[model samples]
Each structure stands twice: as structure tokens, then as C-alpha cells.
Target: MNFALGRYFPADFPLHRLDPRAKLLGSLLIMVGVLGARDLPALGLLALGLVATAALGRLPLSLVLGGLRPFFWLFLLTFLLNAYFTPGSPGPLGTSLEGTSQGAVLTTRLALMVLTASLLTLTTSPIDLTDGIERLLKPLRKVKVPAHEVAMMMVIALRFLPLLAEEAERIKKAQMARGVDFEGGILKRLKNMVPILVPLFMSAFRKADLLSLAMEARCYRGGEGRTSFSELRFGLGDGLALATSGLLALVGTIW
Candidate 1:
């Protein structure tokens, strides 16, 4: 449950109360804007807006920053690769100035996207997300899409993500206790992980079997004529969110 991305933090803020559909739409717009931003200035503005939105959601600064910890090395590697390898005019530091600039911009764009997406999951519950996705994909059913089943599978995957993380942590600790050297060379570390991964896979399979059996026992069926316990309603806040998202998208496009 301590894993950052899929964990939802309950709060009484406006973002938490927004209809999932509105939040999903806004998130899509922001993602598009971030992906298309052509310069650092545009990214900076989008980052500022995301930070403000997180503040409005009452999310702690620590939570926002911590969400990107797992990707720190990935970001660094991307920056180094782009900075040194990209063909451009050489800078005083022996790296191409254009490459360095592009690397920095790319890194910032990815980091901002991760932080912004964290806000969506932090404020929205898995159930609400599932429902919203099902509703959105309902139109696809005309093409024989199993919208409900697809949504259910997505929700189940999200629910299991944290469980797997926790299990990995526990397995790591147990291996470390038994003198496994997990911090040596890359190959050595990978060899050390064999013991952990084998057991983890076995455990995952066992859990899957049990879940299947439990669902069968309960006579669980796919979504058909399903009724929701919570009704989704669009309000003024949703309208504002959509308008703001559209504005951000426009600015990013023009920048």
C-alpha cells in the first residue's frame, strides 16, 4: 500500500470530488500537452499548473516528489544518452549544446508527466477509474468490444500492482538476510535475484489460482445489466477543469 502510483489518498478536496470522467478527460489533455510541448518554457508553465493542481488536491509535496523516485536512474540514463550521443554543435563541455538542451527538455517533460499522472491516481479511487473507463469504452461495444470485461481486467491489474511491489520488497529483505549480494555487478545482482524471482512467480500463480476459485465459488459473472452503487454526476467543478485543461492544451500547442 505504500507504493506511490496506484495508491489513492483520501481527501476532501475538489479534485477528489470531481467526477471521474472529467478527471480522466483533464488528465488526457494534460498528458497531450506535456507530450507536445516544444520548449522548456512551455514545460515549465505546465509543471507550475500541475503543482498548483496538486496543491488544490491537498497532496503533500513529499508524495509528489516521491512518486518519481523509481524512475530516477531511468531519467538520468536518458539524459546522458541524449546529451552525449545526439549530433549537434559541440559545447565547451564536449557535449553538443543542442543535445544537452534536448536531453534536459526531454527529462523534464517525462518527469512532469509522471508527477501529473500521480495526481490523478492519488485523487481517484480504483473503482471510480474502472467505472469511468467502462463508460468511456461503452461506445466501442458496437464493434464487439467487451468494455466491462476490459475495465474489470484493468482494475484487477491495478489492484495487484502494489501487492506485487510489496511482495518484491519482502523477498528482497529475505534474500538479503540470507547473505545474497544484490549490489554487486549487474550480472551478479541479476544472478542473485533468481532465488527471489522464482518464489515470487510461484506465489503469484498460487494467488491467481485462489482468486479464480473464489470468484467461481461466488458465481461471479462478467458485467451485464450491472448497476452502480455510486452515481457519477458532472458539476460546475468538472466544467472548470475541462476548460482549464483545454486552455493548457492550447498554450502548449502554440508554444
Candidate 2:
């Protein structure tokens, strides 16, 4: 019910005031750093950086880590696969020592990656994010890339995440009220999900259809000659943020 991912949290802070382009680029840099991390120390540094960024944004710890809730299964699966299958010496409970270490490292990297991305969306508004992405891709226009359209599609997908989550939750409750048992063995649980999935897909298509109609009614056209109310300007803060992120990325790569 409390969807935090992709939903902007309004606040007056340094992170909130940062230009969207800066945030996007900075987040990407941090993600690169996360990928480059090969040891516990490197991962610790990345984790500290994320905590600091969250602090700068004045975001709640709960909100910052809340993004991981949805990816719990992913993290678990990644760890399990690595721990059970990777070649290494014996470890606790039949897991290899090397495999366990590898699993922990990989899981940490993934968590950091998710946190970085979530923080970007948490701090930046959807509109600003769209503009930022479009502008970043603007140079691709020379190569005939539909920059604006691509940006719009990405943002629209993010916006729909919470809507779909809420819709699924509502459908689940409704089905439960009608005597649908969602608890049982794996097969039974999966079978019970049929009712939920069918209606969810139907609702999604219906919403998409309605959206298309609304756009047509508004005389919607591509971003050929559109102008924005607020122009994006790179200022001192943006430069500082980019420089710091660049430094972090370099350290991650070379260290």
C-alpha cells in the first residue's frame, strides 16, 4: 500500500534542489561504482555514500531502504545461486566459503544499484526526470532517435508502477473476500493467482486504452515544436555533484 519507488517525495533539501540531469548522471556514476566494487571495503564506501546522499536529501531511512522490499526475492535468489553453485571451499550449511563471499558481494552490489536508482526517483519529480532524460538524449536527435518519445515512455512506465501495485492489491483483497484462498503449497498459490492476474491485465489494458483516447482528445502530438515552461540550467550545485560523482566513479574503477 505504501509505494515508495518511482513516487517523488516532496521536500526542500539540497538533493531536491539539484538539477534532474545532475541527479541522473550522478546516480549512474554511483551505479558504475557499485559494479566496480570487488570487496567489502569498496561496498562499504558505496553504502556510506548512499547514506550520506539520503541524509543530504533529508529523506527518511525507512523510505530510503523501503525500495529494497520489492526486490527481496531477487536478492535472495542471487545469493542462493551463488552460494550453492559457485566453486569454493566448504562453508556453513554446505555452502562454499568462496561462493558465500561472492554471493554477499553480488547481493550488496545489487542492493546498492537499486538504492541509487530509487534515490534518484525519490528526489526528482517525474516531470523534471522526463525533461532531464530527453535533454540527455537530445544529441541522439541527429541520428534520428525519438528522444522525447523515449523519455515519455520511460516516465509513463514508472508512473504506472504504483498504480498497478495498488490495483493488484485491491483485486487481491476483493478475491479474498469472495473466498479465494491464497495460502497453500506453491502450485496451489500459483493457481489462485490466476484470478488476480487476469483482472490485473484487463485493468492495465483498459487504462492504456483510456490514456490513448485522452491523448488523442487533447490533440496530442510528438515533441517536434514543444517548449517547456522552465528551462534546465546547469548551476554550481550541479557541477559539484557531477564532479564528486565522477571522482567516486574513478576511484571505483581504479581502486
Candidate 3:
């Protein structure tokens, strides 16, 4: 199933092996900075960072664009809404003296955030990200946030999304064979999706229950006293990445 959301960088670049904590922190900082960015230059730099990271991971443009496919319509909607309704205070926000500057800010922020986050996922493995998350939520352990459990769940979900999507696709195909008209008008298509969605939901619930039982059977209690086999250690490269990200974020915020 293509839905697996595979941890699939080319595995040749130095970035691929860098500490996941570095990647996660960098991504968060970049996202915050990009979302807060109002200036075009800052956004451009953020875009460049995203592109550079993608390149560092040796990811193909096609792969990146494919991820962007689901957002094409979203982008169109954002642009139209911004261009149409935004107050033309700072000289018409649309193409020419049309939309509000606020709308433009929102649209640009959304785009930059999307680009940055996509790059993060592209470069970092799901497992590494989960581990990073558990580490990050260490503070929450004091408050009983079940951070490790949440991280495990997310890792599992990411691992399975593609598989489920594939399963949905297969179900759709089988229904189509049975004269189910799923490829019709939008409303019709959505309703037809029920056949796929119901079973998917059931499967997910069952999987969750089974996973919990299995973990309990294995004597897995919370993260308490849990030692990881793959102990994460931040190295010089991680420091460098974090420093670079911090500098960029500070610049964006200050500017």
C-alpha cells in the first residue's frame, strides 16, 4: 500500500542520519517562523530552506510535488478567498489593488508552513520522529501525559496510513466492480465512500484494541523506567542544525 507514508529518503545524504531531535526541533522552529512571517523575503528564505532540506535528503521534486497534489485545490481556495474578500487597505489585495494585506499574509503563511512541514516529513523517518517526540514530551511525563503512548500511536498511525489508503482504494475498486458508482458528482462520490469508510473504521478500532492488549501482555507500562534499544544522542551536526534553525527563526521573527 502506497499509504504507508514510508520513511523514504534516499539514505545517502548526511541529513538522513542526523539526530531526529534536530530535525523535529528545526521543523517546529521553522514552522513557527514561517507562519509568523509577513515579509516576502522571509517567506522566500523559508521556501529556500525547505527546498534545500529536500535536496539534502536527495528527494525528487516529483515526490515533493506529489505531496502537494492534495493541497492544489486548497491553495486555489485560499488565493480566491484572499484575493476576493481581503480588505484592499494597502492598495487592493488581489492581482491589482484588490485583496486585503491580511489575506495575503494568511495565504503566504499557510503556503510556507505547508512547504516547511512537508520537507520535515520527507527528510525524517517516522520512527525517529516518534522517538524525538517521546523525548520532547519528557516534561509531560511529570504530568502524566502518556507521551510515549501518544508517540507510539502516532508512529503506528503514520506507518499504517498508506496501507489503509490502499485498502480503501481496493475496496472502492471492488465496489465499483459490483456496479457501485463511486466516481460521480462530489456528493455521490462521498456517499459512495461509506462502503470503504465503515470497514476502515472498524479495522482501525480492532487494530487499536489488539495493539493495547499486546503491549500490556508484553509488560509495557508507561515510559517509566523504559530504556530504548536505540538510544538517541545529539551530536555536533544536530547542534549545527538547531543553531541554524534558531538563527533563521529569530531573523524571521525579528524582521
Candidate 4:
């Protein structure tokens, strides 16, 4: 129910204090660099960077690992599918290898991607992150894609995440009080979730309704020339961060 899907990193770290523009840009460079990586060693390097950055953010190792929980099966499935299905060389070179290498490559790639993404959320606060993102995408306005509006929508979504989490937590406590143990086995837990999910969803809809009304009352229009309270600026620290990430990208590309 912790809807804060973003900001995996706790605040107070030096990285956490950097401008959102720097963080967003650095995160993009890392993601693009890692995802573009074709070789295993380069991918491994990307993973290492993610770990180091996460440590820099001062997040708990357990929290980092926990994010990988749901993806365990995904990793496994990716590996299995790739290993068995990635058309391979026949004869002695092929060695009839099925899921081993392909699976490993796929899983490794996915893990690195996830780690990189998680690092972004861990370090950046929700509001500033979205604001930076919107500002970054502002250039896309020429195409009439409504970049600002989209950004506002994303901001709203991120803002509600923690609130929704609290609501979910409340629902969970209420269910638990009724002897609905959500800690049971899979099916049992799923069955128990019905009570919590139903009410939580209803509450979310209600909240959404109220939010719509609130926005309407405030005369909120689309993000047309909407100025931000905290303007994003790139400082020396931001430059250093960007340079570091770019250097990493360079290394990744050549390696």
C-alpha cells in the first residue's frame, strides 16, 4: 500500500539535495546507457553504478532487494524464454543450449534496468521530480502533446500515491481487526485482500471525485504557461553530477 512508487531514496543525502533537473537528466543518461548496453560486462558495470548510486542515496539494502521481489519471477521468466527461444547456432557451437545463456542475459538486463529506475525514485522527491520532468518535456509542446498538462497529471498521480497508501493502510488495519489475516498463504491472502481492496478502491474513487471538484473550483486550467514556484536551476553540483553520469555513459558505450 506504500503508493510512493517513486523516491526509493530517503532524503537528507547530498544526492537527494541536488536539483531535480540534474537528477532527472542523470537518471535518463544512466537508463539509456544501461538499456543500450549489449555486452554482459557493460551491463554488469551499469548494475554496479546503480548499486553505488543507491548507496550514495543511503537507502537500505533490504529495501533495494525488496523491490526486486515481484520481479524475481519476471527475471526468471525472461531468462527461461530467452534461453529456450532466442534462435541459436546449431552444431557444436550451439551445443543445444536453451535457456541458460539467453535467460541469464535477459534477467541481468532486466535487473539492471530495474535498479536504475529504482535509484531515480529513491533519490528524488515526488513533487520536484514531476516538476523537473515537465520542464524537461516542455519542448515537446510544439507537437501539441500537452507536455505540461501531462506533467501535471503525473504530478497529481504521484502526490496521491502516499495519500492512497495511508488509505490502504487504514483499510488493512480495519480488515485485520476483523480477523482477516493478510499474512496467510497466497490464496488465503488474496481472499483476505478482497475486503481491503474493495474499500480502498472505493475510497480512491471518492478522493478522486473530491480532487476533481477541488481543481474545478480553483479554476485550474491545463499547464499552459504555468510557472513553477521552485524554478529548476543547474548549479556546480548539478554540473558535476551530470558530468559523472555522462562519463559513465561514455565508458559504457565504448566498453
TM-score (all chains, Cα) for each model? 0.91, 0.94, 0.79, 0.75
Better of 2 and 3 by lDDT: 2
Separate clash counts for every candidate = 0, 0, 8, 8
**Each prediction's whole-model lDDT (CA):** 0.85, 0.89, 0.73, 0.75
Candidate 4 lDDT over residue span 1-255, tens digit each = 423244345579888888888887887888778767767888788778877887887888877766676467788778666665667654233433544665676688788777666666777777777788887887887887787678778767756665777788888898878888888677898788799888988999999999899989988886765677777778999999888988887787678
Comparing 3 with 4 on lDDT, the higher-scoring candidate is: 4
Candidate with the larger TM-score of 2 and 4: 2
Model 1 residue 221 distance off true place after TM-score fit, in angstroms: 0.9
TM-score sort, best first: 2, 1, 3, 4
Q: Name the regions of candidate 2 deviating beyond 4 angstroms.
A: none
Query: In model 3, which runs have C-alpha deviations exceeding 4 angstroms?
Result: 1-12, 89-105, 182-184, 213-219
For 1-255, candidate 2 gives per-residue lDDT tens digits of 656667788988889989999999999999998888788788888788889999999998987887688788899999999999999899999999999999999999999988888888889999899999999999999999999999999988888887898899999999999999999997999899999999999999999999899988988797888899999999999999999987887676666
Model 3 residue 62 CA deviation (Å) reads: 1.9
The prediction achieving the highest lDDT against the true structure is 2
* lDDT score of residue 98 within candidate 3: 48
